[model samples]
Target: MTDIRLFQGPELLDHAVALHSVYVDAFCAPPWNEDAEQAIEFLGSLRVAVRRPGFTAALAFGGREVVGFATAWTTLAPFPTDRCYPRAAAGLGPERTVDWLCGAREIDELAVRPQAHGTGLAADLLEAVAEDAPDGRSWLLTSLRSPRAMSFYRGQGWTQATHPSPDGEGIVVFLGPRHPAGALAAQPL
Candidate 1:
């Protein structure tokens, strides 16, 4: 049996190491190829991210070990000026991007251990982290290279957005329910 735990704000700080370990284990494989040093840097970034408004996280445990996890927070109003967000915002355009994402929850991370794959843990963690979004609005970005990941998101009712990630990172954007993008995507061609 898998046990799942939900964490918010300050409570997330306590599980920082465990979360990082899961992230490193999950992303360091195949398409991501992130190194331990990069994972540590991500941990540093996570420390600040959890402090943001509407931060939330969920973790799945197999016995005493972390097997999967997810994290998210509300997107910024003007959008972020740093990293790939600006490029992503540019691709989505100002109005739709802000309207759908500004106050909407953005799932920042989701990972599952190799041994725990195909056990439905990822979906459970995703649901837990996104369950509290106001009006059911939520979104996320993932690599275009990960077919399995993209397929899983699609299978879970996530809609792909027209915007592409900046920096040629092969990033693909997805919007959950109640997002304007979903309506746009559903319209007849």
Candidate 2:
């Protein structure tokens, strides 16, 4: 059996750190060559505001351990991600316009411990996040080079944005809704 917990207040801080560690472990350096230690610190620092509205951490428990987790938050008219500028630029380059500024849900991290994979833990965490999204739409950007991540997202019914993100290597944007009308399509993965 499995259970999920949505954190708030001081508990939000501890769980946020745990989720960051999981993210750094799962995402790795990949095509960007991110340093693992740095990634952990960078993402962990985001806990400051995640204590507020929209941000949340969902942990999937397998007996005494946390087997899977997710970290995400909502974006409104002004955009909360600007605060993540320094961190985002580390891997994603310049802000180049916060496309989800008008309002959208952004998933920063989702991870499941290797020992707990294939138990529907990740999907369970995602479902909980999706349910509480600012709205039903969650938008995220990923390295088009990571087929594993992209394929998993696609399997969950996330569609690539028609418009490729504005970047040198071109990160693919996956919108959880109907592909955003005419946003631009991605090359086949």
Candidate 3:
């Protein structure tokens, strides 16, 4: 039997090792094809990210062994000066980006081990992180190249904020339900 647990920032910090292990196992395959270095870097990033306000995480375990996990945090205004944010804003448009995404919950990561793929753990983890979003706003970015992943998000009611880019190398942003950006859900591809 599997168990799902909701964790606040502090608890996430406490279970960092388990979280990192599950993350590496889940994302190092297929579409992600991440290296050990990338996994280590993700752990480093999580260390800082959990400190952010409104950070939340959900961990799935099968008798003490983590099988899946999800993490998210509220986006702040002055909007993250990150490289990806700027590019995302370009695809999503500055108005919708700022009005709906700023101060919203951004799902930074969600992964489930290959052995558990057929199960519904991913959806449960997603709901755990998003259900309590402070502003009832949530969003995430996934590669359009991965049809399975995109299908899963759509199945969960997430609307694509950007269409498949002509270059075919860009990430697709998804806006959760009730977000103002959802109105632009059908913007031209």
Candidate 4:
């Protein structure tokens, strides 16, 4: 059986190395094709992310070895413009972006070692980070290139709020099942 632990604030840095290992194992191949530099960059970003308001993380351990992990934090109002935030904002438009995502819990990362693919560890980790989301509102952005990931989130009842054009080469946003905007997500833009 796998043991999962939830950590909040900078204290999560205690397992940084192990989490980095899991990240590389989960993302450094095939569809993701990430590299050592990217993993190191993630570690640096994680240091900053842990300091964000309402930051939370979950680590899954299999006999002391980290097999999966997830990170999340409360999104603040005024909506950020960094990274993929613009993509999400552009997709949802300013009003819906503020209403649905500004104060929601945003999942930043969810990675499970390849060996743990079918063990339900990912779902557990996701739930652990999101369990205490404010007002049960949570959201995430994922790449449209990863069909398996899209399918997994959809199976977990996350509603895709963005649909990419036919080329399908961009990111998509998802609202948690309990989010108030989930029903409104299906409405025409």
Q: What is the lDDT of residue 51 in candidate 3?
A: 89
Note the Cα lDDT for every prediction shown: 0.82, 0.61, 0.84, 0.91
Better of 2 and 3 by TM-score: 3
Q: Model 3 off-target regions past 4 Å?
A: 187-189
TM-score winner between candidates 1 and 4: 4
Off by over 4 Å in 1: 163-168, 178-180, 186-189
Better of 1 and 2 by TM-score: 1
* Clashing residue pairs in candidate 2 (N, C-alpha, C atoms within 3 angstroms): 162-183, 162-184, 162-185, 163-183, 163-184
- Give the candidate number with the greatest TM-score: 4
TM-score preference between candidates 2 and 4, better one:
4
Q: For candidate 1, give the lDDT of residue 73.
A: 93
> After TM-score superposition, what is the CA distance of residue 66 in candidate 1 from its true location, in Å?
1.3
Superposed Cα deviation of residue 48, candidate 2 (Å):
2.4
Model 1 lDDT tens row, 1-189: 999998888777788788888888898878889888899988888888879989988888889888888889988788888866865676578887788788899999999998888888888888898877878889998877787898899888888785454344567678885565687753213
Candidate 4 to truth, TM: 0.97
Output the lDDT of residue 43, model 1: 84
Worst 10 residues of 4 by lDDT: 180-189
- Candidate with the larger lDDT of 1 and 3: 3
The TM-score values for the models, in the order shown, are: 0.91, 0.71, 0.93, 0.97
Backbone N/Cα/C clashes per model = 0, 5, 0, 0
Q: Of the candidates shown, which would achieve the greatest lDDT relative to the real structure?
A: 4
